[model samples]
Target chain A: MKKHNYSAGPCILPQEVFEEASKSILNFNESGLSILEISHRSKDFVAVMEEARALVLELLNLEGKGYQALFLQGGASLEFLMVPYNLMKTNGKAAYLDTGTWASGAIKEAKAFGETVIVASSKDANYNYIPKDYSIPTDADYFHCTSNNTIFGTQMKSFPNTTIPVVCDMSSDIFSRSLDFSKFDLIYAGAQKNMGPAGTTLVVVKEEILGKTGRAIPNILNYEQHIAKESMYNTPAVFAVYTSLLTLKWLKKLGGISAIEKINEAKANLLYTEIDRNPLFKGTVLKEDRSAMNATFLLENQDHQELFDSMWKKAGISGINGHRSVGGYRASMYNALPLDSVQVLVDVMKELEKNS
Target chain B: MKKHNYSAGPCILPQEVFEEASKSILNFNESGLSILEISHRSKDFVAVMEEARALVLELLNLEGKGYQALFLQGGASLEFLMVPYNLMKTNGKAAYLDTGTWASGAIKEAKAFGETVIVASSKDANYNYIPKDYSIPTDADYFHCTSNNTIFGTQMKSFPNTTIPVVCDMSSDIFSRSLDFSKFDLIYAGAQKNMGPAGTTLVVVKEEILGKTGRAIPNILNYEQHIAKESMYNTPAVFAVYTSLLTLKWLKKLGGISAIEKINEAKANLLYTEIDRNPLFKGTVLKEDRSAMNATFLLENQDHQELFDSMWKKAGISGINGHRSVGGYRASMYNALPLDSVQVLVDVMKELEKNS
Candidate 1:
């Protein structure tokens, strides 16, 4: 069966990246060594770390302000704690925008460290839209926001222009679009989304924002430790990093984030248009704040849910089910997801509408 | 050139394991989805996590016990902090043996949480061998030790026979030999060495030892939270876990750890015998306490260091340099390092001797 993947994370990747990454895992660049076998500190592997970091900066367009890119272990979950542990020390209060489940998780971890003031919350409306018109606390140490809500299929289309530093968890929508990164002091995301796999976390932090926390953060959790050691503080996930570099390389060859954003926008627009035009389906998230990364919808007649599910499965479409927490259908169209895959889903939706 | 990989961690894996792992990275289980592109919450992925967990216990012969194996994102570095956060609230000091770098790291993190005692330390002699006649403090909550010292090339031939809880970091030499796991309350290892890769950490813990900590641990760092959720507490390193399972499956097919132990013993013996018999090279660690995983050696003439290095590199051997802290050569004969590679290194030693 020909499958079109719409998984939220551990999501789609370029074919060249997959081939290049797989070859390295087998025999790294013909070094007669598997990327899985080499020490992360070795010259070859160190070069990989360097290139991966360099490409990340190139993708972000923030090259010269001494921003450190760390490829650390522990997914974004650990970063939720570490970010607050390191950045939430001064004034003991940080402003957080409660966007969805992941944002709530970050807020919970930050609260454990100190004070967390939710500047804005979308929970009142079941997180169908991004919250608006919230005042940022001037006394807060930093403001935290989840750039894109994976479950609710909502995104902060434009970041809040605030005086306090902005720390964004861009786990799902990172690298899918270009943004003015100068607006963020810290940006973190798990690689499962648009990067490579699920082992590593990408942390882009302004060098000046760290070292303020008086708390003795464990070495592994401290971004400063990884930054000082060039992400080689301990053995890194060599294969994941290698594959990530390949993905980054693929992104670079495809004209970087600018080119990807256009493709991503096109893909998302195609699917969402199909949802709005089709009577059988109803899009879940607010049209104004609809996510350009994850397109979620539901069958209007719930009785046909199982039938629609079976149709998609037999059509070789996978991971289109919405999060169990949300419970309809979610089609995550990440950077590597081709337009053809989205078109396939749109075709399936149209066919379902015609039969009905 | 044929390379002999001796990178202590992120070490060698069987060629077959790499082949199988690489296939999944491109197209997993013929699902036409890159393993990197699948949702961890998907049924296919949940089964991978379940099988990987099962395989770890099966390899350790820990089935039917009250033990649970978790595949976590943070490497053993995070375990240093998590061990204390999960089990240190007994209102008593945790007893730790200072075997080497990693053991001391655990002790440092434990001190941050509660009272911790350094029961014994091999550091007095530069951790060249395991300490003997260590007393487990009477009121200690747990006795922690590092099972194998990757840097110092030492091993604990036998564990302390005590009624108190025993926690061990077996990152360097796990599955290299049969272990009496009955004595261990918890055992964790970073999967860079003899296991699989570097991103995931394997933890086998007795379920009853947790939830005693009164202090609130950050959710991501809590073992009890992970156990209750069956290691899917968050998005895990799915690819690393799958690869580790492939390695475990390969281990089982080769007749489990016992069969591998004999092969490991022969590989270590072959290298150590050459180091002992040859006048050009001298083994670093004590003969009795020599590690079966990494065998360290130093040349008699310091000037010949480059000569030895070039010889090995020309023969396609990489990562043979000893750690900078200890200047010499370390040939890490991990589980996947065939005895033929060891013989090749021995042959290099003999060739060096003939010229000298």
Candidate 2:
């Protein structure tokens, strides 16, 4: 049985992407070299890096618009520090929205580099919904927010238009849907979720916005340095980046982000409908703000927990167990997740409802 | 004929390791999930992280020691900055030996956080030899040096026993041979060489040595934070670390570092002897300081360069080309490189000599 993988990041990648990547691991580009053992500086892997960067630009429709793409390391956690180190200047204040754990983590790192203000938050509501109607400070250097909260299963339906530069942590829902890519000055997504594997972080930065921060940014942490080197400032995560290129290739074939958005919406709708309609289940988070990437839900009747668990297990479903903080289920409908798997999950939920 | 991989890092791994790792990418632990897509927090991957950490200790004979092992990202490049940020106290000086390009790069980052002194340097001679007779300052926060200059093919003959904490960038020659595990307070190696791949960096630090530096280290760059989180202070380089575990398992099955050291020595001796004896070739670095890992050589007569290049190419050898800085050939004989492969290169050298 083809199991539904919903364990969040490092989560589901396209099957063909996995197959192609596995073949490359055996012999990359017929070089008789495993991708895992090839230098990041080699011509073969260099092509992979170039293509990955170009595709990121194409997918975002930012090519020639002066947005540079960088595949970096240390994941989003590292980017939390890097975002501020590169953009936040001396005495420069950046506004951040504290939506969930990840946003809070980013805010914490930003505070170390310079002054950071939490302009708004949903913490009082336990981060069950994305906070909106927060005014951006025009004097702030940038506004930082997470597009999707993986743990909370809440997502910003639309980005706020503002005069100040905007930096986003789009780790969980980056390529799953289409967005106005030009609205933000900087965006970083850890590749574990919708991007690729777990090692590389995709950083898209406006080329002109750098170097104004005044602080001597560490070469590795600086966006401008990474852009100048074309993301090869150091030995990059070769396998991760190569696999990302493959996944991006898959994404393009699936008609890019626009097409994936429809598929993602369908999956999310199917699952959410089941949870809302079924007497035994209830969807967490506000319906308007529920993520198309991660859909969190719970059993209305806690007594039916064993039945729900066994049903999903029997249906060859995996990774539907929600985050420990949420304590229910989260059927992540990432781009690669087919509607068939969502149907299987919905049927299981409906069966539990009928029996219970 | 099978090609001999000497491409430096992500250089070569045991062929079986590649095969097994490729299989896992198809289906990890029979979980019907690709290793690339598996959740890092899952039990299977958690086991991999723990095992990789344990194996680092076991291979170093540091089991039950105060030293903690971390598989991190940003490679050794990030560690260059991280080392200083966490350990270099305010206005306190640390000593460094400028050995080669990488060592020089490390020096650049060290200067960012605190005072750094270059105690000795081999840069006077294009870094063809490791600097010696260096005196350490008793009051220095740490004495730092690169144990091996990969591009120049120079290896440190011995570490100076010093009272101040000794930090070393052992990126190239970390596991090729065994050493006294207690010598350095902190040692970081990029995994592309002997360990595994390019994304994850291996950090070995003594627990007692941290927090004495008296700096407010950022959570991500702080060695103590990484220790507290078991290197999960962030979402780690998952595939890189898992692949590293497989390589470590292979290393352990082959009797750990002691067993691999003999193989490494044999490979280096075979290649270096040819480089020294062949009329068409000459070893680049000082013989005593030559690395068992990367053996750099040049054509004695530039007129015979084509013949030497063609001979190696015909013998199914790859990645033996030296770095662009000092170009001729750099046959990086990492631990996974077999004696047979080195012999092929040796034969190629001898063939070039006869042809010339």
Candidate 3:
């Protein structure tokens, strides 16, 4: 049976990327050394680091724009602490929009370094919608936000047009769609979601926003130091970064973010349409803010749970079970997910409706 | 030419470990999923994590002991700061032995969290010898030491029998020797050297030594939080940890540390004997404190440098050029290095002497 992977990250990456990564692990560029064994400073791997950084910028359309991209160890969870540690100015408050658990986590870490103000939040409604019509605090150090809620299935259609520096955690939906790259002062993502594997974090920062905090940042956590050394100050997540580069190349070959966004929307539309019209299920998040990345839904009748689960399992679906926060099912249709797989799920939904 | 890898980390791993790791990256345990794509929480990877943590305890002879093992990101460099953040009590002092670059980096980070006292140092002698007969301060929160200096080729032959908690940075020499497992309160090692690759740090902490610091540790850096969560506090370095498990399994099959130590010592001795007898070279560290992991040496005359370098390159030696701190050559004889490779190097040294 062909398995449909929806295991929200360390999720689906291109089959070719996996092949190339596997081959490199055996022998990297004919160097007679496994990518796992070679030093990051070796020219072969230095090329990999440089290419991975360049591809991150190229895919984002931020190339040659003074935006530096780095691949560092510690997942996006650590970036929650580092973003505030490096940018939250002394005695100044950073404005945050708490949309979901990840956003709330970001806010918690930011509060440890300086004052954090919740300018807006959708947590009150179980984070089913992205809050709007909130005023920006002009005196805030920066405005931090999560672009997508993976659990509750909400994504920001438009970002705040604030005057302060804009920091975003785009972990789950970074390369799945097109974005206005210049608008963000800093962006971070755990690689397991949309990028590569779980070891490294992808950090893209506009250089000028740093150094205003006046606090001495730890060398390993300091973005400026990492950029100065080109992300090799400390030993990096070499295999993870190399695999990410391969994924980026595959994305580029598939015509970059704009091309993939169309496919992603079609997949999300397929699943959501089935959920709405099938009568057996309903979408979880607000209709307008429904995530094009993770299509979350639930069976309308609780008694149908065992049947639905058994049917999905027999059909070879993986990771369709919903998170504890919102129980039922979540089909994460990331970039590597083909629309055909979504069609399979749509077919599964139709079958479920027919049997009922 | 067949390459002889002696690069100081992201260094040599067992050949069989590399092959097994490569196979798993393609299809982990016949799951038809790349190890890179599966969720860390999946039973397969959870088993990997549990086995990895258990293997660390087993290799260190700590099974059934109270020490909790964790695999984390940001390498040993991250552990430098985490050690003090989690253990250095409020307004308390931590004592550090200044051995080499990594130890100095550890002290630099520890100073940020609490007062750091350098109880002993070897900087006056260019770090050629491990400082001896220094007292560990009893009033200090903990005493920190680097068990092996990768750059200087000096190792601590014996640890201080101190009453306070003892912390060790064993990045370069772990799994290559036998140590008294019950001696230390905390031990952290970056995985690139003898264990595995570059992204993860292996942390083994005595459970009772934590929660005394009173400082709020970030979720990613907190020791107690990681142990409580069984080291899946976040998406760990999945590939690195998986690879490390394979290496540990290989170590166990080779009869664990005691057997590897003999092979390591023989490799070190083979190269050091040539350095001592050959007219062109001389060993760097003191005889008593000489490292079995990294053997640093110097050419007696700079005029023969080009010929010697070309000869070694022709012999397919990689990364023999010593670090700038200690000029001439270094052959890092890790657990994975076969004695035959060291014999090849020794033969080259003899050839150079004959030519001279």
Q: How well is candidate 1 docked (DockQ)?
A: 0.78
**Model 3 docking tier (incorrect/acceptable/medium/high):** medium
Q: Write the per-residue lDDT of candidate 3 for residues B1-356, one digit (tens) a residue.
A: 67788888788888888888888877889887788888888999999999999989988989887999999999888888888889998898999999999999999988887789999899988899998889988999999999999899999989999999999999999888999977999999999999998889999999999998778788778998899899988888888999999999999999999999888888887888888888888888998889999999999999999999999888888888888999888888888878888888898889988898
- Give the CAPRI class of candidate 2: high
What is the C-alpha DockQ of each candidate?
A: 0.78, 0.84, 0.76
Error of 1 at A116 (Å): 1.4
Candidates in order have lDDT scores of 0.87, 0.89, 0.89
For model 1, how does the per-residue alpha-carbon lDDT over B79-196 read when each residue is reduced to its tens digit? 9988888888756679999988888888877888778889889787888888888788867778899988888888989888887788999988888899878678899999988778
Deviation (Å) of A28 in candidate 1: 1.1
TM-score of chain B of 1: 0.98
- Tens-place lDDT per residue, model 1, A239-268, is 788888888888899998999999999998
Clash count in backbone of candidate 1: 1
- Report clash pairs, candidate 2: none
lDDT of 3 at B223: 91
Q: Which portions of model 1 show Cα errors greater than 4 Å?
A: none
Give the clashing residue pairs of candidate 1, or none: B10-B192
**lDDT against true structure, model 1:** 0.87
